[model samples]
Target chain A: MKLRDFVLRRIILAIPVIFGVLTITWFLSYVVGDPLAMYVTERTPDAAIPGIIRARGLDAPLVVQYFLYLTALFQGDWGVSTTTGADQPVLTVLARLFPATIELSIVAMSIAIVLGIPLGIISATRKDKAADHVTRVFALIGVSMPIFWFGLMLKYVLFYQLSVWDLPHLPGGDRYNFRAFGSWQPTTGFLLIDSLLFEHNPALFLDAVVHLIMPAFCLGYITLAIITRMMRSSMLEVIKEDYITLAKSKGLSERVVIYKHALRNALIPTVTVIGLAFGGLITGAVLTETIFNWPGLGRWATNSILNSDIAAINGFTLLVAFIFVIANFIVDMIYGVLDPRIRFG
Target chain B: MSDELVLHVKDLYVNFYTYEGIVKALDGVEMFLRRGDTMGVVGETGCGKSVTAKSILRLIEAPGRLDDGQILFFDQDFETKETIELDLAKLELEEMLEIRGNRISIVFQDPATYPNPVFRIGDQIAEVIELHQNLAMDVLYMKIAKLELTLSEATSDENRAEIEGKISYYRQQLDDPPEPDKKSMREAAKLKAIEMLRLVRMPAPEQVVNQYPHELSGGMRQRALIAMSLACNPSILICDEATTALDVTVQAQVLLLLNQLKAEIGTSIIVITHDMGVVAETCNWVNVMYAGTTVESCATEEIFAKPLHPYTAGLLIAVPKLHEVKDRLPQIRGTVPNLITPPTGCRFHPRCDYATSVCKEKKPLLEELEPGHWVACHHPLRS
Candidate 1:
């Protein structure tokens, strides 16, 4: 099949996946009771409850409500937040919070990929040497250590301990000093980008980056470890392949043989992990965000879940599922490119 | 075939350190390849045939170390016209790179897995040419075009002198062009790659050049591999079970192609295989390896007619003859010994029918028993 056709088929196939996710989310939310329950108090009138249910299409039959939900979703109306933002559109709330998560996730993912892949390659190439053993231990710690604990530890050592020792201590939590940038307006909602691009404040960008380091590292460490392990094993397998021997026999430099010939094939599996891990990073940022006090979707989702905000919960689940679907679609496309054996029909 | 020795491997030893034990993969493997001979190193599975081949290129990876040996390559320095004797085993990996693909190339078994699955067939072939030849493809193209144009426009005898001057100038440029642009280098390599594909008799060279390894048939992939190996016209070409992975028909075709290419390219070919028939068909000289050691080395006809070592005799008897009918095709007694702690003396002693107290107690050195026939057996069958 042509590349275009293959891509189109993949995109078309994603529709059902997203639809399935949305349906599941809707069903799960239905089981959780009325979303407007929190609004009802001892002073609340029984008459107001019916108006709220009717206005939100909650009084309709289950099937009818589902159809209405689907139609409204297609029309870009994700319903109003019931508890968290109170009367605000779910989409708007999600959109406002989405960029922060995206920006943090992007930074976290960059750290994972940049460090993970090379570390893995080094470990594999060195095999059982000191370098290999060191990375292996590092990866072990990264994988086994709880994210919350790691974040807390990082804050203790880098923030708390540094302050105690009278060293240049990093900010413990939160994203930038709001007191200094109170007058600053966010153009992109990504402080780092907005600070530099629209605000033209290099000092603001620096501060944003400074606050970003600990949280991003804390979030990315697990994925980096996973990627490093994946890359190492993949590279080890690829390097042992007959093609690698052939490449070496061709009198190509070691760099060419390893990087050009072997690395591409090895990166195939690593790319898969990276793509999936990216989606995980976005959704799994809850602990990191909560610990660091970063205002992102994960923190917002936490409050929404605690408040039993079904609409907001559904919106978050659907968005995450969509991200996963998109990530997998991209991974599949990359597989086709990396491995010629994969023919999309 | 030239009498000059192209490569001589002496007392080669390779050991693989595994969790179980150290696998003495290649122990004292000794062989020689003359300038233009298709020598076959035949042995059964796990006899270290591939290890010997890899040792020649110093391509042994970690865990498998070249324990001890001298791979003396009589490399001809083109500019000086002097033969440089370099020990392959002694040289560092970086130093070996110049000779690995340029002076010696190997085509491995499993052609499907050997050529990188991701790269185009043409690019893989072109990459080798670009590395060794160091010619700017774009500049080379321009020079060739100019020369062809000059030759085509040579209609008058009066201006022949001027045309000759232009032709020589273009030829000089073709011989030594300036450093090429990356894009032009690729283009040049692609053109050379097409030429190589044609040389290997790959059908529809133009289309095949653009296709990936998976797009080609088994025979075609092997052919493409051969083309890649022979791209730089290395002095020695090693085929490590090159045709063993193919079906009977394609095997014959590839073997035929190897023989034909050997003659055309003037490369000293080393065919590593376990099949005796392949030895009889393509090789002039056969080096029979038995359990990481050369049990016998002689002319192919001599070894077949007058087998020396008992192991060699057993191997010959094992081949199913067409005319002779038997209840069970003659089989060797014991399985190949584990190299980790191989039998005390000779590795094949336990498996040999002619085993005695001395055979078990002592390792036998390869001795020239007769004219041009070497055997490492304590007891030689006097048939």
Candidate 2:
């Protein structure tokens, strides 16, 4: 099959997957609680309650409501959030928050790949040695440690305790300080890039990076742990393949045999884990965002749920599902590239 | 160089430490190879034929240790007129790099899995050629510089004559026609790899060189592997069941290729396999192994004509004759003994029809029953 057909087929297949996610989320969001309860108060007039229900389309039948929701969704109408009381569109809210989450995820994933893969390679090649044991233990601790606690502990050490040493206090719980940075004019919505591009200040970029460091680390800890452990086991498995022995028998150095011959084949499965982990990272950011006060989508989604802002919750679910499906599609393309057998098939 | 012993493996002992027990993979295995000879080490599965071949280059990994062995490699170059004896086991990995593939190379079984899938054919073949050939030239260059230094200081005619002779010898080692430029060495190696591919009978050598291993057919891949092995003109070529994975026609083609190489390249060959037919077709001398030990060793024709060991007799009988009519072809009874806890005395006794009390009690050493034939059995067959 041609590469063009393969890509096209994958994209067409994603439509149903996205539709299924939206249907499930729509049902679950309504089942949790009635969205009308937020607007209804003890002193409210009984006549005003029906008017609010009709205005929000809450009085419509379940099927009618779902179709209305789908129609509005296709027109890019994410509906309004009742949590802030100002009634802001969920799309506008996402625009304000997603950049922060994206920025955090990028930092975290970069750290995961840069540190995790080589460390994993080292662990596998060293096998049962002290280096392997040390990496395994570190990954174990990283996995078991709760993100909230890890985030708070980092805040305590890097943000609070270092004040006495005259080190620049690390920022946590927010994207950037509005007072010091002068209200960040939206450019890319990514603060670090925007601070330099629109604000045109090097010091602001540095401040943005420092503010990002703690939350990104806490957010990325689990992903790093998972990738490291996955890569080590994968590398160990590929190293035992007959091709590796063949490489060594050819009198190639141990370096070439391990990295070139073993690592490339091993990376096929590792890439899948990485793609899934990226999708998970976007959703898993809730606790880290809460602790660090990072104004990201997770924090907004949590606020939406507490206020019974059904439309905002539904919209968030659709976005998350779309991200995951797209990530997986990209992973499949990479798999074909990595293994020729898959490419031809 | 043609008449000299190129490889001599003496009293080689390899043990694999497993949870069950110490698996005696190779028990005092001994074999020697003269230059230009094609020797076959034939055995049934699990009999340590492949292990012996790997032991020569110290390619055996952990869990398996070379407990006691001396792989004496006699390194002699006719062009350079240099001679050295290297006990391979005693050499460090760095030192072994100099000899591995450069002086001794291997072609493994299952060529499908042997060449790295990610690498281009040319790059893989060129790698060995560059490492061995480039390093050889570097060493030669160093020697030439030292010879020039010695010649400058020498006042006596005797000393000058000696220095000049040594200088010319080292210079000749670089190139036959004295293309002494070091820069062209890498290009020379690449050209040599292309030539080697053509020699292996690979069609469209230029196209195949750029293609990945996965693009090639099984026989073509095996032929490419053969080309890589012969790249450095290794004096000792170990083919560890090289033709086992090939089809019958490809097997014939490969075996024929090896025979042609033996006459053309003049490299001593160690062909390890379980196939009796391969031994009959390609080998001048044969070593029949039974459970980590050399049970019988003789000239290939003699072993077939008048088999001495009962085990050898059984193996010969197991091979079906083309014209012979029978309900069932003869088979050697009993399975291969578990190496973790092998049968104590004369491992073949359990299956041997001629087993005696003495055969069950004593383990026999290889005895030279005839002038050139050796057998490790208590009760020998009469010619």
Candidate 3:
């Protein structure tokens, strides 16, 4: 099959998958009871409750409600946020917060890949040596340590203790200090990009970066460890292959043998883990965002869950499913590039 | 064949440091390859035929060390063109790199797994050629640039035709070009690779070059591997059971190809296998190994006609003959000894039917019982 047709087919196939996710989310929300309960209080009037339900189309038959939800979804009308954004359209709220999550995930993924792959290569190439042992220990710690605890510890050491010692320290939480910058207009919705581009303030950009370091590191640590471990084992297996011996016999330098020949084959498995981990990072950053006080989708999703905002929850689930499907598509594309057998097939 | 040795391995010892114990893989393996000679190193599985081949190029991986030995390579220096002898065992890895793939190349057993599946067959072959060749990239670029300019300026069809011919000539030279500048060298190596594929008699050399190893048949892959091994025109080519994994017909064809290539390229060949039929057909000289040590070395016909060492005779008898019918084929009395604590003296003592007190107590040296025929045995079957 042609590359274009293959890609298009994959994209077209994702529609049913997303639709299935939306249906499941709706059913789960139905079992959870009325989202309007969170809006109700002892001070609320009884007559107003029926009006609110009717206005939101909740009074319709189950089938009618399902069809209405699906219609609104396709018409670019994700329902209004109930508790989190307070009457703001869920899509708009998500859009406003989407860039922050994307920016954080990108930074976190960069940290994971940049550090993880090389650490893995070193660990495998020097298997059983001191370097390998050290990397193994580091990976063990990264995997074992809880992200929240790790983030707290980082704050305690790099922020609290350092500040007490009158040494240089980073901010404890939040994307950036709004009071210091007086809330410059967000051009890209990504504070890091906007701070530099629109405000033309290097200090704001640097502050955004500084604020990002701890959260990104904490979020990326597990992924980095996983990637490193995957890479090491994959590399070890690849180097044992007859082709690697042939490569060495060809008088290619050890560097080329490992990096050019073995590494590419080894990376096949590692890339798979990386793609899934990236999807996980984007949707699963709730704790990290909460701990760091960063205004990303994770924190909003957490609030929506706590509030039982069914519409928002359904939207978030569908979005997560979409991200995962896209990520897998990308991984498949990469596999095609990496392995010729896959490309031809 | 020339009297001068292309490679001489003396008292070669290799040990594998495994968690279980030290595997004495190669024990005093001694053999030599004369210039343009096709020598067969025949041995049962695990007898260290492959180990001996790998040791020649110092391609032993970690956990397996070249414990003690001298792998003397006789060659002429690249620049000086003066005859030189270097101990491959003692050469620094950097120095060894100069010899590997350039002066000595190896084709492995499994054709399926030996060529990287991800790379094009042509690119893989080109990589080996590019590693050894030192063609000038700038000259190639200049030649191409000059051709392009001449073609653009030429008004007559005849002049264009003449320029195109010169361009192709210069382009072929690009195939022999050298260095780290990847693009030009890759193009040059690719052109050379096509020529090599053709030399190995691969069908549609141009198309096969672009195909991956998995896309080709077992025989074709083996041929491609042979092409890669011969890309640099190495002085010595080691085939480590190169035909063991093929179909019977493919095996014969590969053997035939190897013989033809040896004669055409003038590269000394080491055909490592346990198949006596392969030895009978292809090898001029045979080196028989048993339990990590060479048991006999002689002309192929000499070894077959007058089987000496008890182990060699046992091996020969094991091969079923078409003329002689029997309920069960003649078999060696026992299995090969474990090399870790191999039979104290002659490693083959436990397995040899003719083992006596002397054979059990003392290791026999490889001695010349006849001119050009060496056997390591306390009791020679026909001495």
Candidate 4:
């Protein structure tokens, strides 16, 4: 086949992948929660219910509603979050929360990458040795423990038990930092950003960093363990390949062969795992944000669910879908960047 | 110079530590490759030919370990040393990289499986360049462009240049490289890559270089890989049953290409194949392996004419040659022995027609019966 034609085919294939995400988001809003049930409960006046239903556009056909939602998505209108009285647009909510979530997620991913890949490589290379066994044990514990427990444990140890971190007070149920955040503004709506942009004092930056550390670490710790194990297994498999053997035959250093040849190939599968996890991270840290009172989407969604706020629920649901789709998309793009064999599809 | 062996695999032993027990993959096999010799090691699926090739640079992973062996490489051409006996058991991670792909490259049997599905063909090739070469930036770029241009028509020199330059720029931003050079080593590497691809007789060498493994046909990808292996001009080339996955016609084509490359470039080759036809067609030396051991070793014509080992003779008889097709083709009884606990005596004793009491009690030594021929058996079946 012609080379250009093959690439063109891949691009065409990606269109469906994007559309698939959109469809999944729309379908999830309907089945995931009873929007109708919540819609009526708020204003159950028999006469007002229909008007509310009609006004909310819930009365429209599924396909039409979906089309409208998709059209609005393109127009950058993610609809309104009815519950927060934040009444902010869906995309706006994402914009406000995305930076924070992304910052948290990126920090988490960075932690995972920096620590995980090396640990995995080391563990794999060492094999049955004590060091390998230790790493394996750590990875096993990391995997078996749930992220929610880790968040609570960290909060207890750092904030209560150790008294290492003295938060003057928790933010109560939402994510606004009412504490004396010294001269910080919402430049990026991210603590690191606001701290960097607005605060002149080094202490504020340090505080913001300190605040970020616990939640990010809690969120990313499991991912790091997962990545390390995945990377190790992948690396182990690739290192045994004849090509790697050929690399060694060339008299190249073991470090060069594994890093340059084996690790690079191993990353192909690892990218898939990392991408899915990144999507999960982007959807907002549910447990970690709740434990830290970080006010990200996870905490917001949970509160909205409890309040039975349909708008917030739908908006957050669609937003989570958006983040997931975008995450996969970005991962797809990165696969090509990292390995080169992956096309857009 | 004729006796200047480029690589010597001495008494190689490889074992995989599975949950069951130690899987003796490769056991007590020895061979060598001269500067320009293309040697073939042939055996059945579980016979340890591929493991032997991988043992050269200690590419085995856990729970596989190189139990015993030495890999000797004469890297004098690059001003390293004349004779370096590489211990297969231990090596620092960093030092092993130089030996892999940089000095001794390999091409696998499955061409489709060769590429990482996540990366582009150009990037994968460029990575090898990044590791091995110190070429100018412009040249490195030109080389990639030229390689891409050969594989895909749309991947123009401009686009290749742009992409490669972007990669270099990104690397520079990370402070990974020293200062930028006037003529990019990137372009030179690209040109060198193009020249190598063209030499492999790939049509549209410019287009094929840019095309991904999936984009090209099976034959083309194999050719591209062959071109990639030739990129650094390594002293030893290992083709691990490289043509086993291709059709007979494509296999012949690739084999012919390997022979041609061997003649033109003087790259010593270790062709790990199970196909006897391939050994006869491509290799100067043939090493017949059975149960991880070199049961018989001889020159191409000599071994075929006067196969001394009963196993080698059995193999020749089992195969239906072009000259005659028997109604009941001769078949060897008994399957490959379990490697977990390999047979105590001669591994092939149970399957051998000439097996005796001594064959079951004592293992035979690999002795040089003639000047160049080596046989390992209690009683050889030579006329």
Q: Which candidate number maximizes DockQ?
A: 3
For each candidate, the alpha-carbon lDDT, in order, equals 0.89, 0.86, 0.89, 0.74
Better of 1 and 3 by DockQ: 3
Q: Candidates 1 and 4: which is better by TM-score?
A: 1
Tell the DockQ for candidate 1.
0.73
lDDT score of residue A201 within candidate 1: 91
Q: What is the TM-score of each candidate against the true structure?
A: 0.93, 0.87, 0.95, 0.74
Which tens-of-lDDT digit does each residue in B15-82 have in candidate 4? 89999999988778877677778888988888998777767756666778888877667665557555
Sorted on DockQ, best first, the list reads 3, 1, 2, 4
Clashing pairs in 1: none
> Individual DockQ of the candidates?
0.73, 0.38, 0.88, 0.28
Is model 2 an incorrect, acceptable, medium or high docking prediction? acceptable
After TM-score superposition, the amount by which residue A80's alpha carbon in candidate 1 deviates from its true location, in angstroms, is: 0.9
- Interface RMSD value for candidate 1, one decimal? 0.9
RMSD of each: 3.5, 8.4, 2.9, 8.0
Q: Candidate 1's error at A305, in angstroms?
A: 1.5
List candidate 4 segments past 4 Å from native: A1-152, A164-188, A198-202, A222-252, A262-290, A295-303, A339-341, B1-17, B23-27, B30-38, B68-105, B116-183, B232-235, B323-325, B368-372
Q: Across residues B136-165, which tens digit of lDDT does each residue of candidate 1 receive?
A: 645566656766777777787767677677
lDDT of 3 at B74: 90
lDDT of 3 by residue, B190-307 (tens): 8889999999999999999999998999999999999999998898999999999999999999999999988898889999998999999999999999888989999999999998
| Candidate 2 DockQ vs. native | 0.38
Model 3 chain A: weakest 10-residue lDDT segment is A33-42
Residue A179, model 1, lDDT: 86
| Model 4 TM-score on a 0 to 1 scale | 0.74
Task: Please report the candidate that would top lDDT against the real structure.
Answer: 3
